[model samples]
Target chain A: MATYKLKTPISEEDTRKLKVNDIIYITGTIITARDAAHRRALEFHREKKKLPVNLQGLAVFHCGPIVKKENDKWIVVAAGPTTSTRMDLFEDEFIKNFKIRVVIGKGGMGKKTTKAMKQYGAVYGAFTGGAAVLAAKAIKNVKSVEWYDLGMPEALWVLEVEEFGPLTVAIDAHGNNLFEDVQKKVEESRQKIYQKLGV
Target chain B: MEENILINEKIVDDVAVKLLQLAVTELPRDVKEALQRAYREEESEAGKTQLKAILDNMELAEKTRTPMCQDTGVIIFYVKAGAQAKGLDKIGYALRSATRRATKEVPLRPNAVDPFTQKNTGDNTGRFVPFIHWEIVPGDSVEITVMPKGGGSENVCVLGMISPGQGVKGLKKFVVDTVINAGAKPCPPNILGVAVGGGADIAMKLAKAALLRPLDEPNPNPDLAKLEKELYEAANSTGIGPMGLGGKITVLGVKVEYAHRHPASYPVAVAFQCWAARRASARISSDGKVEYLTHKVT
Candidate 1:
């Protein structure tokens, strides 16, 4: 339940201090990646080929940004977090191999991801689900992009942002996941709710 | 008696593009009011915070003319075309052309990809990417509704085939279980459209089409309305709250639509819409006049 101002290239130490339900306002650079980009990154890792961008100590955002090309420059129109769990299968490996310290997305991840967060000293931050315009306003710049062939949603977008969150710490570095907790609580109280409804 | 309404192809094109633009940039009045109501009644600070952010985002998107969410999603057209309307054959081409224009102009994220080869279409339209569903009505005007359903919520959609003996109770259990299982994935404070009794595909279509109705409006059937109310209360009581951080309002509204089913089958489908709930509609008269039903006619 604590509030923090995080400036990236964050460390394992900084991420470890984040507890589930805590709030964080993040600053500095973060990279965006979704399904296809992660798959490509893994392929590159297996081949021992150097990635287009170095991700050490950086945060990764699960987002598919709406960008337009104007005067040879890319303008981010609507950049919001996508569903993070879609990347769960590749995330643990993505975090460990790329040294990603913070993960920003909508929705919380599952057991494997939370386990990876604990083991790798990473925390998952959940942004408001449908707030694309607000997120776009926080971006200071689009530093560069890679994997243009992967398309907008799957491309690697390196962006510079300032105070880029009010993100809820859904999965903390210690493996506490708010989503899992809510599911358990709902299960415990399910009978009472159903009875109240007379169903 | 009506002299076959001569709907111009050009008018259909203009209306379709307008609907796409309006759907992405503006949160309809009913949805905005519902979110405001949820914010007012939310009991938890975390839930309130989530709602506040969403509201702020809505405001910014409207003012700045930016999209509400990045996943402009697959553009779906629900067309209630009139049987007597002229230029019926040209409607599909107009819708597709408008979709491509909107992909660049509304600047919708290029979401259409080749499923087999994994190649982005760059424009949102591919082979049936801007999916169109046609239903013929008695009227002579074409009414088109565009819903920009995001991937997050669509991925969590559920279809269940329950035993008829299980009845309403079984249907209720299926719905509640689906929402709980969705957790933060579909984005809480969601709008649910539940369809019961239709065949598999028809049930799924009914559920999505149900989302076209305003949140303030209840189902016309008393039984369905009652079911919606009960499900809303039960879902909120789960405490999944907004963004699943824990709160009192997991679902803002639920709309139920049911169709007569075969004696041997009872299929239920739930279409989960994220808090964004982006949709808008317009009608084109045979004389080429256009009126936006959801927003101002201008």
Candidate 2:
């Protein structure tokens, strides 16, 4: 597995070739958002209004993490990725609207997302679902947080991250899905097991 | 014999918040060790990679005292109250208050809402902030277990009622089929909790309650325990593996709980827990004392 330190303004070519086990050390501007943020962003876009943040070469993570303040600074407790499927409804639109280059989440995105990635020069990265603590380590700083009224954890916290991954390239620019590929293999194995059991 | 046992509302709230904090910050010892073992034994390269990442996350959460996942989950409190206990409503109020405080303090995700309006109260409290399920038995003290049920695994829960003719074999087939159909939707190497008997609602509740039991802990009934073992073996044999990648271990554990049912109805409910299996519990006494019950970690 190849390893690369990714930064904003990343080219589609570099991200497209990323493999399943490749470890990525992402730096630059990464935004933390989940179901609510995505929905709001889409609503704003529909109204032809400026979004809360710019999307170009940006990485949007599917997370609504818990945070605590110590000495007046916010610290991530468990920032593990949530399931990405829930965001599937708006991902393609968000990707195209924002010029987002990398999407970090768990599970896998759908066909529209894959097509959008290929067409728009983006890549989908899969962070481990329950690995919030590990993901927090990659977060070097919280640049700012919008919707503080949404509470410390659920608020959309803009983060400046560094060396952030070990994230899998589940959906490469070419539309190959590691999750689906692996799942197919598993089904085959299951069939073999059933055969052995003669059930 | 009239027994005197009364718990204060504040005490209930305090305990709930503490439980929520622990659920997010601390990786139970048994859970941590099991993930480590899974990491070592996982043959699939991808599965091993995922397992290692989870372990790293656990380490980070503990060291930093941050939550292990962004989806802190809905707070589910399973309370078994002693028949002698007074002021049960106080316990409910405490749970609710604790949920509100934890939303701000523990920084839990705002999970509760108005079912129709689709509005998020943002404090993780609205109608039914702390979903409380109560069981009153003839006893002296109150025992409560808190499970932070995440959306991913909760979505995978299934319920069905079969005729008596279907039997245990039919149940096995249904369970396997459900997991296979679930694929990676609920996340894999999951803990499958099955509740048999009772009516539809009761069966489902029991399924969730079954999840409160520690991983690898056998059921009280030998027959049920044997069934759990069989299910666990069969689930893994499905080759669903970790994260649904092909591997030897599909399910980490299987737990089954049962109650007597009506003659014609055989109700079944399956609750799936992701690899994280985030949960914790505490026992409270009438004298306002508490004992935090830590589950076997790994």
Candidate 3:
């Protein structure tokens, strides 16, 4: 319901102050990780291997960015969020293991992730779907990348971003979930449509 | 023979690459207008913010010649092969070649993967990738449309086989339920394409084909047009809004297509196109004249 500007490595206290429906613009480092990257992170964690970057207090974006090599430097062309629901399986554990503060993506996650956020003091922010160029505009630099064998989209992309979102807080450190709230409203309307159509 | 080779390989490749560029970077006028209308009309603040971001992203993408979305999507070519056109057989090959070339130039995400090995094709070309659908028509010009359908909308596709007696009402219920079940997953303010009748596979094809139609056009069939309008209204009533965060305009449009089915069957299929509906097309004459149907090219 309110807007705030935050920088990362955010503390638990920073995440705790936000509520579902609050708007936030982040100025910090956020890494891109999708389904494959999520699975690999968990697998690597179990194997007791070192990750390319420390995830603690960072925003883990559910994104598979479009990137290109330009004069030997990697540039992010369009780095919008991928759907987050696909990572629902690993997210609770990801939060528990990584101590990350925010999960950024399109499409909200499920109950398990919400519970993890409430327990671990994290939040879910939704970037507009298909708004890739705007996303790239905010990405000041592609600081580094990993897991290139999983291909560009699935690889771990380290991005340095500035004012990187109008990311609407859909799930917060408390138990509030905006998607669940909207689903209830939709169900009520679905009934009326059925009644009128006699279906 | 030289003329044939030039048209099939070079002209087709140029057209295909340019079409891909335009399709990904620029939202079609009708679809852009629809999003603008949704933005102006959306009452909810969250929905408006979502729409504004979408519009701004679109503008930036166009200005910078960047892909509008990171997904870029699965490449599909809906081709109108003129029976009278020369080198009709090579159109498919040309499209595949063009896909590879476009993949590098436009830098499309390499989406095609070998299912068994789980490895990407790197060039966006693989077995049955680019998924061309061919239609033969009564002219010397071949029309090609490139619709890069994103995964979010593709995941929400549904098929229903209800009792034949339920008719339009059954179809209505099916669509409403599908959209609700999809929630925010498909990215709301979506455009839905519904197909009724035909066999199951045909029904699915018809439904996806329905999405190729522009938002500005109503179904030419009067009864179907009315059905489209009613479904459009029913869908928006769900108030799923942009990204399903809650708002009044859940769907921008609903298009319905039909075929006569077996008396016992009432197969219905629905395909969803997310708010970033992207497509562009061009037609090439047998004599080598090119007409850009969707957008004017310099």
Candidate 4:
């Protein structure tokens, strides 16, 4: 339950120190990416094509924001984390290729992602799922955006943020995953519940 | 011998916007109270933290008049139509116009996407969107309720047709299994709506409609009320807790709705509503007097 404030371009060593249940607040750059964004990023990696922006040493937020153009600038209205499990298929490859240090999202990722975190040095931070406005308060600017053709939710949104979190490290660099841990206990309890219900 | 006010497109459009505003920006009183209770009863630090953040987020959204969650979700309108109400033909156009207006004015995220093209409609409306369900009732007042169905929760809704021999035990097991399999994905602590004994479509429709029930209201049928209580306890006992981090509250409540079966077919549908649980309703009389049913709006 230790708390930390970290800036972007975080080193592998820094991510390695994070443990399950540790609280972290990140300041600096984070990009919003969901299902389509992940597919495109991986497609580009396979083709050896350069992406519009380099994501190395940064945080990737699983979010689809409500944004509007006001006076020729983008204003982020609500930018909360989407369910991270939706991106589980792409996460392993995305981490290996992009070298992102922090992954902020809700729910949690899968075994592939946990193994990747241990190998490449990354942590999964769980923000409260429905707290969109609070999440938006930390965002200071839309640094830039790319792949608008993918639509807002699936587009790549580069954002500059302040101390933007209260994120719990649900998966850490050492292969400890809070979600998997909970799932195991839930299975054990379900057996007992089934016995009682006579199902 | 009766005095009735004429209903028109203008009034319908204006009222729809007000309903949309309240639906996205304000959580209902019953839901807020349930979350507060979960916060007080939560045992683990992770559960406590999640509930606290949710409560704080509600206050912020209400104060700032912004959306509580980014999804804002797909717009759904439930209409209880009055047979005697005028301008029934204008309701569709007014509601569609209202959806477009709210997308820009309420700044609601345009979430409607065409599955074939994989392109967003950008205004949250397309073919059959802002999907309306109409029920004719014996009254002179038209009531409209709006529920924004988010992708996370909607993605997990399930339907199962089981052998009639399995009966109640099998039905209950299916629900608990659904909750376990859903895990943290639907963003538990969830409010579950379950429908039994209808056709697949009917069961799903009834299940979603059941979610409009306030948390404090139990089913009038004593047997159904008992079933809801048992399921609610079973879900909370699993320790999925808030955000599924393992604690004392996996579900805030369970709501069950059912139709008499076809003797051989037993269809069960589970509708999952995340902890946000947002909806608002309004009733308009023939004389055009509007009353906000869910929230106290000025």
Compare the candidates by DockQ and give the number of the best one: 3
Each candidate structure's count of clashing pairs: 0, 12, 2, 0
Locate the minimum summed-lDDT window of 10 residues in model 4 chain B.
Answer: B1-10
Q: What is the C-alpha local distance difference test score of each model? A: 0.87, 0.77, 0.90, 0.91
fnat, candidate 3?
A: 0.85
List candidate 2 stretches off by more than 4 Å.
A33-56, A65-78, A86-99, A116-121, A144-158, A189-199, B1-8, B86-89, B286-288, B295-298
Sort all candidates by lDDT, best to worst.
4, 3, 1, 2
Candidate 1 segments exceeding 4 Å error: A11-13, A35-56, A90-99, A147-151, A197-199, B1-6
Provide candidate 2's TM-score on chain A.
0.91
lDDT by residue for model 3 over B1-298, one digit each (tens)? 4464324668998899999999998888999999999999999878888998999998888888888888888999999988877887778888999999989888788889899999788898899889999999997788999999899899999999989998777788889899889988888889999999998999999999999899999999998899999899888889899988889988989999999999999999999999889899998987788889887688
Question: Best lDDT goes to which candidate?
Answer: 4
lDDT tens digits, residue span A13-122, model 1: 99998898788888999999999999999999999999998998888999988777889988888888877878998999998899998899987798999999999999
Q: TM-score of chain A for each candidate?
A: 0.98, 0.91, 0.96, 0.95
**DockQ for each of the predicted structures, in order?**
0.64, 0.48, 0.76, 0.73
The docking category that best describes candidate 2 is acceptable
Docking quality category of candidate 4 according to DockQ thresholds: medium
Interface RMSD for each of the candidates: 1.5, 2.5, 1.1, 1.0
* Docking band of candidate 3: medium
| Tens-digit per-residue lDDT, B1-298, candidate 1 | 6554445666778788888888888889999999999999998766777898999999998888878888788889988888878878889999899998888787787889999999889888898878999999986788899998888899899999999888888888888889888877788789999999879999999999988889999988897888899988888888889988889989989999999999988999999998989899988887777789998644
Q: Please state the i-RMS of candidate 1.
A: 1.5
Error of 3 at A177 (Å): 0.1
